[model samples]
Target chain A: MRWLRLGALLLVVGFLLGTAVWLRPFGSPTAFEMDDYFLKNAQVEAGANNVVTSVVFDYRGFDTLGEATVLLCAVVGVAFILRRVKP
Target chain B: MSVVVRTIARLLLPWVLAFGGYVIMHGHLTPGGGFQGGAVVASAVALVVIAFGAEGLKGQKNLFSFLEDLGAIAFVALAFLGIGSTFFRNVLAGGGGLFGTPVPFGPNPGWLNTGGTLPLMNWAVGLKVLAGLGSVVLLLALFGGKEDG
Candidate 1:
């Protein structure tokens, strides 16, 4: 069992190191066409100076909605669990 | 916890709140947005809780819950506003009305009166996050207590 664990750990480390060595260079992405479009047009279309906010609240508003829903659910769960019970 | 800690928290409360408001208000123009701002404000709540106690926020749980509900409703309503074109559409952008200023292409000083629905949504989400997180903390702190506090 000990030998098995050591071999598994070595395999994982070796795989991670190999992948890291072949990683892409910084500041360059494999696909940036969509990003370029957002950078250029987010301000004009969304009318927001911050492109990240435009993407979050305008282009991907549904995701924010979903996130809000999740937060609501979480709060509800906490409140329910923590509710005081009458004797 | 102590007098000094409580005093510091009291002094810092307004500044933290102001910074959080700034983040939410300038979500369209700056790096911080609704979620970040809301988290900032919620941190203020936590600071208060730590300095004082869970009982310090006694009787305020319902208010937080109500605010969270209001924020959720406002966010949905804002989304429905753009349903004429499409859900979450930028219908109010460049409309020359409230928060409807057209932004000039390329980088410049950011205008506040732009990103119509975006800013509204930012406010909505900010409220939701602050209330939600603050209430969560309050609930956890007050849990299993003698009373609701």
Candidate 2:
């Protein structure tokens, strides 16, 4: 049984290695049109020097909103779980 | 826990809180942002829990919940400000009111008064994250199967 588990683990690791080897090199973009646009106009359009913040909070804001909601839900759930029951 | 640990925590607390504030405030110009800054502050709160225990925490959980709701509401309201054009629009940018300074193209020092709705959103998210994470830490410390020292 132990050997079977070890064999499975090895198979999974091998698959992951093959996938990683097949993946494209880092820092190489397939297209630059969007990147070019953001670089050229983020400051003027978003009116912020930090393009990353503008992108996170402005360009992709709904995602951030969703993230905030998730966090809120998690906090609420934890609070509920920790609350003492009258029973 | 011990006197030495407690003393060190006391000394480090203010600096942690200040650094978190800096990250949130400088979200538009630096590497950190509302969520990141809030997490930093929350870590300080956790440190307090570990060093002093939940009994040492002053505020109630209800207060933290209220602050969390307030942050969420304010963030949504700010997002709606952009609805005049589209959702999440930068309505305040270049408008010369609040956070509306127009920034020139290229690298510069980056103004605090710029970024229109960005700063407002950052504040909202920062508040939400701070309260949310702080509440989580407080609750865990309160009910973690170990009595407060």
Candidate 3:
């Protein structure tokens, strides 16, 4: 059983390695149209020096909203799961 | 908890909270933003839980949930502030109002009052994350308790 578990772990590791090797080189993207546009215009348009912040909270505000919703649900889930546990 | 653990938590709690506040407030000016800052604050809460146990957190779950809801609602409301142009349209940029200062064309010391609705949104996210994570961990700790605190 131990050997079987080791073999399974090795298979998972090999698959992960293969997937990593199949990906493109680091720091190089195939498409820069949108990225360039954001980089160029994010400052003046978003009025924030941090381009990433502008993208997250302005250009991609909907995504951030969704993230907040997700966090809410997570807290709710934990509360519900432990609802019966009295402190 | 051990005395050393309690002492360390007491010493570190204020610093942790201050760091979190800095990250949240400097979202537009620095590397860390709302979510990152919220996580930092949540970690501080966790340290308190670890040192003091969840006994003190009793009855606080509702407060956390309420604050989380408030954050979520505030974020959505702020997003709606741009309904005049379009959703998420930076209406405040260059308007010279709340978070509406025009940014220079390049890198400079960023202003706090310059992110339009972005800073408000960052604050909303920070509050949400802090409350959400703190409550979740507190509940889990309560569940794992071998006896009531």
| TM-score (all chains, Cα) for each model | 0.93, 0.94, 0.90
Q: Can you list the residue pairs that collide in candidate 1?
A: none
Judge the docking of candidate 3 as incorrect, acceptable, medium or high: medium
The DockQ-based CAPRI class assigned to model 1 is medium
Stretches of candidate 2 above 4 Å error? B146-149
Instruction: Please give the fraction of native interface contacts (Cα pairs under 8 Å between A and B) kept by each candidate.
Output: 0.86, 0.78, 0.81
Question: Candidate 1, what DockQ?
Answer: 0.68
Listing candidates in order, what is each one's chain A TM-score?
A: 0.79, 0.85, 0.78
RMSD of each: 2.3, 2.0, 2.4
CAPRI quality band, candidate 2: medium
TM-score: model 2 vs. ground truth: 0.94
Against the true structure, whose lDDT is highest? 1
Residue B89 displacement (Å), model 3: 2.2
Candidate 2 clash pair list = none
When sorted by DockQ, best at the front, the candidate numbers are 1, 2, 3
What clash pairs does model 3 have? none
Which lDDT value does model 1 have at B48? Answer: 88
Tens digit per residue, CA lDDT, model 2, B33-52: 99999999999999999898
Identify the candidate with maximal DockQ.
Answer: 1
TM-score of chain A of 2: 0.85
- Model 3 residue A31 CA deviation (Å) reads 1.5
Lowest lDDT block of 10, candidate 2 chain B: B140-149
What is residue A36's positional error in candidate 1, in angstroms? 0.7
* Over 4 Å off, model 1: A1-10, B144-149
